[model samples]
Target: MNEDAQAALGILAQQIRMAGNNPDQPNRVGNANPALSSLRNPVYGTTSLTLAGTNTTSQLSMRGCDGTFTNINSTNTTTTGIDALTCVAGGTNTVPDSIAVSYEADRFNTIPTGGTSSLPTDCLGNKLPVVTATVSTIVAGTASSADVTYTVADNRYYIGTASVANVVTPSLYCKGNGGASVQMPMVENIETLQLRYGTVSTASTATTATVAGYLHATEVLTETSMALLANDAERWAKVATVRICVLVRSENPVAPNAASAQYTDCAGNLVDNPPDLRLRRAYTTTVVLRNRRL
Candidate 1:
């Protein structure tokens, strides 16, 4: 080959090596691209793990989902009681034992306006104004023992119950009911989810509290996270109180090299580290509690 042609081949080989792409090697293992396989369920997020070995029989211990377990049998390519999730394999099938937690929902709809559909007034009617049975009109404050006299802004007048059970702060996706059902896909392959309860002071500060039965890093979210958050959210909404905020964090550390190789030191010097991972997109929502009793 001519010198120019040889030099061109050398550059091409270098580029191929950088990409980890091998064309001629036989039985190569590392050249395959990594892949993400997910399982889906009606309960909220992905919840199951399955893999296939060269053998016809394979078993995977299902974890997560309110701390439950089942064995997956791949020999038949069928799973027992594992729903809403599918096992996928590709890219030399180099699957990681752990995956980053991912929560995704379809496009969100704008909060509705007008009448009770609006905020301050919960959509669940947990805060419907109560009418007093007293002879004269009376206004009840948070401390007032007697029922408060109030007129309904709308046609419906609901009787006063002790309080309404708050549903979990619903992560509502525009299901295209206005059009089509929005698809919500979630995965918890990371360390798990951690929920921190904070008190919203008049100063607008969120003071974190160590709440028992709260979310933790080691806990796979499944239904528990959704359940606990809903309970706290209901209590928060029923009281007719100040705006409250909940802090949600993924226990899963951002994968190393998940971000770009660039880093800024304490002094703001940019340094490049080529061996870093990039951060992937994730989903989480914060619900605010407003409307307080005076």
Candidate 2:
């Protein structure tokens, strides 16, 4: 269970670190172009994912960086978080026990035609398409090819969870060239999954260099909450880290009079005597946004 939780965290954290700048704010940090991209809320936190009497659940969606991106496809019709190309989970689209979310990522390979890995791939080592288009630019009376030919395609990941028999499993949706979402079941017996955004408040949303401290997504100052210069999108850009916490159940039941009914949850709250008799453990990770920090 611990291993499974850790593995899931790694996958989520890696994408968070590679998150691109929100395209809504023109003066946001990161070199990603705001024109081609319509991302405003790089890290968009949707409503809580409530399971059957489960406490640990939250829906989070983010935009993957392109330095060079677009709105992803969704089954929902809600326009919430449109700036960031995010949609709230609703309209019979499943929630709590299960939900659908689009995981932002770059589907193309940018190896400049020569790299150790002979093929492009998704999160799993599956073969994928590569960018083969190039642009010609002349500088100093010399013509040079901007070899971005290897950086074209973008992937749309549609993530969700499912319950089979009695065990619940979380799956990762990998989008392919033909625009097909492949469902990859990640781990099993995951009881709860929660995520909290780490954001910083600045005097002006237009600029942010060093973050003082990370605050809760709601606690963070915004023009709507504090009437400060800090806007919604800018505050999201100030997010430097993401905290992921997951709880998994043991496969086999504990021996008689051996298992502890109480366990600590991802929120640091003491969950006294859970309903089930199976052993459970919580795993957590705080991932740094490498692209944002840089």
Candidate 3:
């Protein structure tokens, strides 16, 4: 349980870091990428951790690129084009996680002359294939630039949990090309998972903003509704930090003679009466979203 909880924390932090790509800035007049999704709100989190009871749901969703993509469109694979996004419409037609990326052989020879192209594989490294749609131009009048394009497979990931009574296990969900959300078991025996979003406020004179305080998902949504920002993304843009807390218990109940342990939970409440004798532990960490800042 300890190892699983640690790993889960790391994985959750990574996802939070990649949650937003700053797709929606102050300037939305004409700046929109066709390869990315129309949903600009990067992070959506919810948690119900009170002394009363626990909520077995973590709709904490994040949207961002995962790895370099290979455009499934053969026509978009121009010999001269490089790092082009082929998912022209990201609203309805979502991209999926696909096969390895293939590129032009000996394309290095092409770059020296002018017509250059590539399809490098994202082996261990993942990078968002962000680029413009137009073709590259080497010379003023030369037609050497070819249209480069690639696929944007799966980009959005979220946290979910199994709803079995008394045996809640937090899981991860992701969709490919607008497919059904697949539940991925991240950590077992995670009875309670709580999250808090740190809201930030930037003064007119300050260059960067600091976290004002932490609020639950519902409160954040309410603030977003009151904000005088963009109609769609005002809620998610205000969150600058995320606090993740998960409770992991042993696989089996402990010995009867073993003293029942009392502990404090993720919500800072002391759990006086434990349900069982099984060893239980709480894992927590505060993740800061650098993408939310300048």
**How much lDDT does each candidate structure score?**
0.21, 0.44, 0.43
Candidate 2: minimum summed lDDT over ten consecutive residues — where?
A: 49-58
Give the Å shift of residue 38 in candidate 3: 15
- What are the runs in model 2 whose C-alpha is more than 4 Å off? 21-119, 124-136, 139-160, 170-179, 204-208, 215-232, 255-259
Better of 2 and 3 by TM-score: 2
- What does candidate 1's lDDT look like per residue over 1-294, in tens digits? 123223322322222112111122122122132111111111111122221222111111111111111122122212221221233222111111111111111112122335644421111222322222211122342222222122111110001112125512111110011111122212121211212222222222233322223222123222343335333222221211111111112223355553443444212345465232422222222222221111
Minimum summed lDDT over a 10-residue window in model 3 is located at: 46-55
lDDT of 1: 0.21
Q: RMSD of model 2, in Å? A: 11.2
Question: Please, what are the lDDT tens digits per residue for candidate 3 over residues 1-294?
Answer: 788788767766765664433334221222144223222222122121111121121122231221212343233222212223322232121111111111111222111212243432221122223222222234454534343332222232333457677866554332222122232445566665566778776332226667788865445545543355443134556677887776777777773634565667776777778877777777899988765532
Q: Cα deviation in Å at residue 266, candidate 2?
A: 0.8
lDDT of 3 at 108: 24
Rank the candidate models, highest lDDT first. 2, 3, 1
Can you tell me which runs of candidate 1 are displaced by over 4 Å? 1-180, 184-195, 199-234, 238-276, 280-288, 292-294
Indicate the TM-score of model 3.
Answer: 0.53
What is the C-alpha lDDT profile of model 2 across 176-268, one tens digit per residue? 322233435555666665555565555434355455554433343333433454454455556666666667767666735433767787667
Relative to the unseen true structure, what is the C-alpha lDDT of residue 44 in candidate 3, on a scale of 0 to 100? 20
Task: Give lDDT: candidate 1, residue 252.
Answer: 30
